[model samples]
Target: MKTISIFTQKGGVTKTTSTINISGVLAELGYKVLVIDFDTQCHLSLGYDVDKETEYNVEEFLNSVEPIRYAERGKHQNVSVISGKLKLSTKSLKRDSLKKPLKKIEKDFDFCLIDCPPKPINDDLGFGEIAIFASDYIISPVDYDAFTLDGLTTLIITLDELQQREKLTAQYLGFFFAKVEENTKDFKEAYRELSESEISSLLFKSYVRKNAFIRTSINTGESAVFLKPFSPVSMDYRKLTDELLMKIKIDAK
Candidate 1:
């Protein structure tokens, strides 16, 4: 099975949205996908409308005395999720601790997508870093306005350092622009700059433009593709999924 982490140092960049949307699209295409809500906000958990009273959450799974449990089926048939809890970030988890637990359940799903938490105030490394260590590829969904030099530098440099020190095998897949407005000059300029930057080679051709339908779908606990399959943004997601599958050399069953 393949594993991926959707993370960025900055927030409000559609990080969780991208993770769930991609997982949903992949599931729609007949792939078994597992999405881990690695954030304390529990947004992904709410996306699938998982029961808040469940005895098990990410916090329990990570810090259990016994074996780590597998993610359970969500509202989507082909998708399973380990729901994040309110105090998830407060738990002190070991570096690479997830590697074994994920491996145990890897055979059950075709792909695992982790929705990483936002960077904490003082810590240099957190669940986001750990998620990458357990992934095969890293997708950074960036909101151009918030992708500041400090955030970019810290994220990039930390990845490089972690890859070396942790002996991790994951590689960066690319950056994808999310919540963009094609009509705005500022948005266009930002996209152009990102594509022309030194790391231009690591940019996905398909970008998710601002779509009202996206919020509508999210609010209703369904994917835009499933709710409004013919919408432009839904089509963009399909194209992005196609691009991602081709890049990974995985054929849809």
Candidate 2:
């Protein structure tokens, strides 16, 4: 299976939302997708509405214990989720702790998407590091704001450091704007600057436009792609997902 971590150093950039909708889109295409909620807040778990009924959360998966089974079925067919718990931050897990567990279930899924926390917790080599070490690819969802550049820089530095020190294996897919306000002057300027920068090649051609229905869909325990398929918000996600699939050369099974 190809494992991807939806990550960025900054929060409130729709990281969790992207993971949810991307999984929804992949599942819609008949891919067996597994989503791991690695954030301490457990927002991804809540988004899938699998928070309460799960027999085990991601904590057990990280613990590397015997007889552990945390994969909870998602609302969509061909989708499974391993819920996240708030107490996960306290665990002292090695940077590569998640790799082995995920490897065991590699053949069971077509794709594994991890919803990473905004920043490292517990220590420098925390959940974020663990997630990256276990992933085959990384995708960052950026926002149009003053801090966007700083966040992207930090993420790039972190990945570089990991590559040099830890032999990081994950390939950086690219960046796509999430919750974008395309009509605004600030967005236009930010997009232009990023497109002209040194990492310009990493900018995706498709983005997710800002929409009220995105938040409403998550709050109501459904992904916008499935909740309102014909809406602009849903269409944006579909286009973005399709673009990403093309980049990764993944076809529907």
Q: Across residues 133-173, which tens digit of lDDT does each residue of candidate 2 receive?
A: 89988999998777877778777877878778779988788
Candidate 2 backbone clash number: 0
Global lDDT scores for all candidate models = 0.76, 0.83
Task: Give the Cα-based TM-score of candidate 2 against the true structure.
Answer: 0.91
lDDT of predicted model 2:
0.83
lDDT of 1 by residue, 1-253 (tens): 8999997878788888888888878988888988888888888888767654474677666654355544555345788777787766534676676776788777889999999877732355588877887889888877667445347657777677767876877887777877878789877887788778887866788889898888888887776777777898888888888878776774223
The C-alpha RMSD of each candidate to the native structure, in angstroms, is 3.1, 2.7
Question: Residue pairs in steric clash, candidate 2?
Answer: none
Residue range with the least summed lDDT across 10 consecutive positions in model 2: 68-77
